[model samples]
Target: MSVTSAATGSGPSRWRAGLGRLAAGAALITAVASLPWLSGNDPALTVLRARSADQDPTPEQLTAVREQLGLDEGPFAHLAHWLGGLPRGDAGTSWVSGDAVLPQVTGAFAVSLTLMLGALAVTVAVAALACVRTLYLGSRRRLQRGRGAIGVAVLAALPKFLLASLLATVYGVWLGWLPSSGWQGPASMVLPSLALGVPSGAVIGGLLQQSLPAAFNEPWARTWHAYGFARGRVARHALRRALAGVLPQLLPTVVGLVGGAVAVEKIFNVPGLGRLALDAAIAQDLPPLQTATLSLILLGVAAGLLIQALRRALLGPALRDGALPALHAPAAARGRFTRWVVAVCALALLAVITAGLLRDPLHVDTAARLLPPSAAHPLGTDALGRDLLARLGHGASRTVALALVVTAVCALTGLLLGMTAQIGAGLTEVVSTMPAVLAGLLTTAVTGPSAWGAALAVCLVGWTPYAAQAAALLEQERASGHMLASLSFGAGPGYLLRHHLLPAVLPGVLRNALLRLPTTVLVLASLGFLGLGEQPPTAEWGRLLSENQPYVELAPWTVLGPACALVLLSVLALNGADAVAVRRRPASARTRPWSRGTGLRVKSGVSAG
Candidate 1:
């Protein structure tokens, strides 16, 4: 069936899906609006403390604050009031500032929107540049394999905050080419845009690079070539085809850009919605926080809908004809060289972890503060005189352990739900829109910020990607000839699942979990950096980076250890994922009936029958 037909279904089904999405969105909004009650903390006290940290208010003053802020009403009534006022441009009043929430949110959103737009442009440019050679080369698969692949992987692995720090240090402090902090003008937009865009763009570019080769190798492209179609025209058509497959990922990419902007804004000191939300969460200011959360949700939903529309448009005639190929895992470029790279990264990581474990991470020497690398302090000391080597070693376990737990949970949940087809796309899309940082804010309001809260926040939304992947893979598997043959032979669901589906889907899911490890580490570290995870004196990679960021210029060594460790971790996870893909390619190629040679044979046999 065509992509659109499969995706949209009949008119009634489309309506039902649309209604389902609306219901999910409403339910999400309702839950967010009820945060005041869901959080056990008294709204009055929270606001009072946020407003005046020094003064402790009495019962009468607390009661007055409650009455003024409408906390006297039940949570439902407050939600109703907020919902009622939303259409009229009233988002209620901020308890901390006593200002209107709508204006503050709007202003912040405008700034964020500007940054998102600039970042979006950069994302497109980078993706295009990455793909240009692949498109030009057309079907030259060998030539496309390794060119700049490592660089792209490295770029994809660099987290936004680290990149922002590097950009600020180089451009803002050292070179004096651009203003690094604050949103001043077009010039000020460059660093943050690059910082936010590069990683996401690399990811998008990598996917496109993989997809375009497959698209170009499709029978229709060969037919067009035979008919003397221009290479450029064929490439454009192939790009559109490839994009239809990749467009679903754009929703997460866009949402992630907005989410990553929280830390990016903090680093650059921009007054965007993400920063605003973070600040509100920190102060327990629910009014603006709620508004900001709702706005981000709306933005995500709108972006999803728009991207869906674009996908349908891109599908064009293929929607009716089913000319596009079924999507599958992209084969990794294979070689001994790739294996050697992976081994090297793994060894380096192990060395870092091992060396760190033997040292005293908490040992403080006032005289050794900001000491450069020496015999005693291999990685140098921080401003507080704590050994960087010990901290990094100790922090590796903390970071990697948390990441592993989160990844495993997300993978298992996603795989189960996906295999059973239990979670609807609408709900998954809505839930996936909530970034870990935003979720952290909500969790912090209820449980207070801690390592567990960060983990909880990550767990809440991290499963969506895996679930989406499982669902897609399940669908692809279901359409395979072996599956059809088994079904025709009256194989029960249980038998098919046990004998066929599990074996086919489990490896991909596990590989996905491995690939996602780096991101989980980054998210956990981001939370720590934001002070929402692992409070002071505990060695966590994110916290280390956060603590040492300010002294980046004065003591570059302080930040280098954690920063390099993060990059290496990312590279390791990526290479490991690639290795897994390469290892599985031979078996997958033989079993997959849709593969080039096998696909043609299958099609011919079906036509003959």
Candidate 2:
């Protein structure tokens, strides 16, 4: 049976599993809900860390803060106290500011929701337009060249900060078309929207580009053309069909806007929950963190569920279950595959080189510590008096560098282990069934908090998913005619793997690696926020959040800078992944000269049968 048949047959089981999933989700949320009590660290110590004092907190001061905060009880006592308050309206107060967590979260939540909704609107509009444009352009063979792949690469790999900076310079400074960065009125939304929407558009366009070729070549489309239907009408019908194939790709990308919005909000100085969540995580304040997580999870889940429903309603679940064109290599375009090999290598090198150029962010000064945002100190000074902007840059560099390393490691591991049959299956089940977070938690427990350990933890947890993918790819291609032909030619297993299989596997592996990179960065940021990532003075994004969280009330930039950096890097990684994953060998490499024909499909692969 084919993959689609298996998927269709398993629908009943999927529905059953969804109920079990909902129950499990409730359980997970409940468990996370209790985190305020379960975090074994001393709340007073967390508060003290934020004091920014020249001298140690006197015993009297410590005792006073502890008594005032009621932290004198044992862990169980605190847990019991917090659980008891759950029956009523109270959740607790912020650890650092001593304000009501609910109020703070609600206010921040308002900002985040506004930004989220705006970004979502922008995403949808841009994505739809992008798909249409790509479809129209794709049908024009004269223009479909290496330029498209390069353009997609640049857009996908462009960091949110870079894009934000470009917008600020072009529109805000020079053209006076829009404000550089702010969230005062409706006008402020324009540039940020473009900043976010453009890359998302590129991703949407790439998805459409991938599947559009096949959709256009579907027998129905060819028949319409054969029947002498006008070109425009036939193109319209093919595009409509292509929409069903590509809309599903937008679901995950939309879910990812959470990270992108965080960066955009911080860059534009928009007060949003992305900033709030980072601060909460940094401060190790359970209530606000809990509130933010609960809200985001619920929102994300809802949006995802809504998109899933939309896919079924508009596209139908049978799109996957039905015979359709896949978003794989266009068999006619093998020459352009070499170009992607070059792009992949260049992208990796560019990341590492960028990491090397960032300035050290840990050099501190006592006098400038905790300064608010000023012209001189653009992102202000953290509690350690290190420049927040500098730290953010360095932290982003570090995060990307480590994530790249980890992604490479994961890809290689998956490729190697996926070659085995029994071992691959066992590992797949283990990785699929078990959560990466659990592995991260255990690795951090063993290694403690450091840069390399964080990388190790990420690799340990992240590899399984990649391995599962790699194993599946291997299985799919192993039975292909090319492999069978090579085997029948008496090609040794090693030669077949090295020449035939590896070439087939490498591009897919590269795509998967790119896809996994953003996820790696997010995981590292989360771990860093938990004090399990790179230590301060070394300046990781999560570490900056952890350190400056207490100062958020005094200098918002301290929190926003790192938060924006985190989100920007994530978006960059995600966009790059999406851009490259759907990338195909450019058809122009195989097409006849543009002057020869109408730049349309001259020698089509599948015909109207």
Candidate 3:
């Protein structure tokens, strides 16, 4: 096909995709904007309580407030009115403050955008460093690679809230090196930015670390080296190729960083969009919450579009050649050391669960309250004199079980949707933009706060990533030579799918789920910390952290036990993922079409294809 003709032919498809995204965004905005109606909360009463908590408004007062806020209209009419005003820069007036929602949302979004940008910069720097180290330093030793993978896993597994808390405690409270709370200046930005950025950086960096090595070993890279290309030049070129493989993940990671900023913003008291959304949800401030949700959706769409453009630009010639390198799991050695580490983490987790099951977590002794660790109470006592050890142990079951259930459901749902291509890309993008915390808030508004509600909230958006991954993997698999040959041989769809697609896609999807297990656990813990999960007097890890956080200084053990348990759980999940990835590596390496020994061979007078 001629270049101009091909471009013309692709125009309609591109336009259709853009329209689809726009429609998806509009639908998502409308759904989220309907939360006020869905929750069955009286807007006037909510606004009244938020505005003047001490005053008891009479029926006349309620009617007056409703009329003033235009709440007399039906939900659909109200939505139409809000949507109508949005384009003109009016986002309706906040029920609580009686101010325009646009300004409030924009101001908060600007703060959030700044934070997100700073965090993105951090992520890029980390990824670049990892790529450079892997490419130039030739750190291909299995032991070094395994250690690097493990370190990244640990860092990636740290929950935003826990990391924020630790940063505040050590840097802000203890060392006094940086301001812990508020957004005063660059100094204040350090802690929150690091808290938000580091885990994401670890994730992005790990992906680059894995990809760069594979790229370096590609036939093109080796051929370039043989042609007497400078080592640095070859490595730099390889970096670009490796990055193309990692670009698909960049959108989700970027969106996730913004979504995750909710907890970090709450912990650090940053006046960002996330914090605003959380506060509005808690107060049933629909106008502001709706605006925030809409803003987040738009951001996700924009990021996705931008990342797509960048990928195209990066793979300019390669796009035509269809020579993009596939990303593989890092080839970390599954040595005794790795096994030992995994074993220890597993044993510790098992012990915690078993010990917790046998203990009385609910037993509280006021007389023994705030006691330090001893033989009687090994993990010390909380303010209510509940044994920390007992609580940690018992909470393990609730937290771990719930996390497992959520992860399993998400993985299964994602796998089915992704494999079947049941979910549209636009819809997946829209749903992925909604943070777990925001989803939990919406669920809480509808069902009230409960563990079930929290789990439901997570399930709502948790499947998007897995679905996206699986769909992408399936698409790649279908485009492979073997699948094409099977189709050419008159193999039926059922046969090809049963004998080829399922076997090829299942392992990767499962591995993606295992990697996501820690994140699921963290999300549930975050909801509990925010009171959207298990109610008070219930032993849950997140609830424990929240309950004991205030008394952390006075009785460090109260918080330490649960905190350590969470960290340990994250480590275990990551190690398990590593093991799974490594186990599948050898098979993938042997089957991979483009290896170092057999590089792409461009024919004369034709393109790189």
lDDT of 1 by residue, 247-322 (tens): 7667777877775578888889999988888777666676787788788778877886787678778876555443
Over all chains combined, what TM-score does candidate 1 have? 0.87
Candidate 3 per-residue lDDT, tens place, 35-93, comes to 77778888778778888894678999899988887777856787788888888988888
Candidate 2 at 432: error in angstroms? 15
TM-score for each candidate, following the candidate numbering:
0.87, 0.59, 0.87
lDDT of 2 by residue, 220-327 (tens): 665776687776776666566555545534543554454325545666777666666655544555566556555555554555445435544544443444433222
Clashing pairs in 3: 356-393
Instruction: List, in order, the clash count of every candidate structure.
Output: 0, 1, 1
Ranking by lDDT: 1, 3, 2
Question: Deviation in angstroms for 438 in model 2?
Answer: 15
Local lDDT at 446 for model 2 = 52
Model 2: lowest-lDDT 10 consecutive positions:
587-596
